[model samples]
Target: MSKISTLQVEKVNTHIVNWLITYAENAKVNGFVVGISGGVDSAVTSTLCAQTGLSTLCVEMPIHQAPSHVSRGREHIEQLKKRFPNVTNVEADLTTIFDGFKTIVPIVSDSDKVNLSLANTRARLRMATLYYFAGIHGLLVAGTGNKVEDFGVGFYTKYGDGGVDLSPIADLMKSDVYALGKYLQIPNSILEASPTDGLFGDDRTDEDQLGASYDELEWAMLEEEKGKISENFSGREKTVFDIYKKLNTINQHKMNEIPVCIVSNDIK
Candidate 1:
């Protein structure tokens, strides 16, 4: 049972497709760029952008620790080309650059922060690569984040995957993201693959981090979006909302286009 009303889903999905065309034209870019991670979000974004009739550059950026993930990303790219021949793939090993940074920055033993930092670094590096190509070739970077992954949990890194000229899936729930994939006629092979960041291979999953399934995420989001929490909420619902609020503040920093400065007019 989806919290998103049928009318609401239809309206939002329509807006998503329309925005793809509008953003591409308004940005004066003939195409879009996406770092496909073999994840549902990226695959959906690439297909949607292509469906809008814009050429999309799908990048496969994998750290050396997980080169196999790049192969998965490549498979998705091949899938993208079969549907939209305008899609192109780029293979970039982010480990080299991260290793370079490791030299300058003291090595840390904490896997939590280290993995988080490395994951974010990979995201930012992918964006940097995407924009470099877009800038030289005249294209827009199509961000691959959904409402469930981004707005609800703040799963994306600021200025990394979260930063983009347009967010085609920003308002969508993850369940609906899958639903939209079906609506868009995406291939089953690409859709059936596990959703992963490929940051660490210890079976680390998105739901493991969030402690909620995509269906549960949609249920909570609908409750919050519609202000149904006043009716009643489970213990887990409260936790989800608390996490949502915390991320709201964190991504607030991500959403800001410029930093606020306390200036005494500087050296004047």
Candidate 2:
């Protein structure tokens, strides 16, 4: 059972849609731009943006994307267009762009390092693509990140997925996002689909990379937030908490704002 209620879900949906509309209007921009990755977060976010009746651009920037994932994204956009006239779906295939980047870049032997670097590059490339459209048209890049990924473990790449003018769902947990997705009537295929970064060339789910399910992570986050870490926690809980802490510590850089060095005026 969900910890959140139906009314809470509706409230969040209304709040997000209103915020998107107000933010875009106050900024005097044409609209909001989002990159659709066929994940629940993106689907829900883009849908909410479309509900605002703004000229929302949903771009699918696939870099060696899985065909199933691509189809899911395209289908979601098609459905959105049928419902929302302000929605526009565009495809920016970045496979060749990525290949061109890899050609001139220095090579590394460490498999993990190489993969991590390439994944981040894919995210930044997608960021650039969103901004490219946002720049040409006066629009702000809307981020598709949830609370757990955005603040708990900093799962997003800095200045990549994290680089955005606005994040409508940053306050929502993964489960909350799911609830909102259902409330927003996002496609069932996307809600049932395992969330992925789509940065890896292969079919690795987010849980495969994170070492624990979103449920486990969310539980750990709740416990940590409540300052309720206890010795009586089950083995599974302990393990999840340990992993969560390690990730949080390692990725704090991504969550925190950039530090500036203030020059002292006093002469030494």
lDDT of 1 by residue, 137-254 (tens): 7888888888876766677778788778778888777777887777766666656766666665456677777666666666766667787643365576777655565655666755
lDDT (tens digit, per residue) of candidate 2 on 1-268: 1245233987778888898889888999988899999899889889999999999999999899999898899889999999999999888999999999999999988989989999999999999899999999899999999999998878899888999999999999898889888888889999999988888889999889998888788877888898866464768778888888888889998988789988788952
Best by lDDT: 2
Query: Candidate 2 regions off by >4 Å?
Result: 1-7, 230-232
Please list the C-alpha lDDT of all candidates, in the order they appear: 0.72, 0.88
Model 1 lDDT at residue 19: 81
Error of 2 at 142 (Å): 0.5
Candidate 1 residue 102 Cα shift, in angstroms, is 1.9
TM-score of 2: 0.96
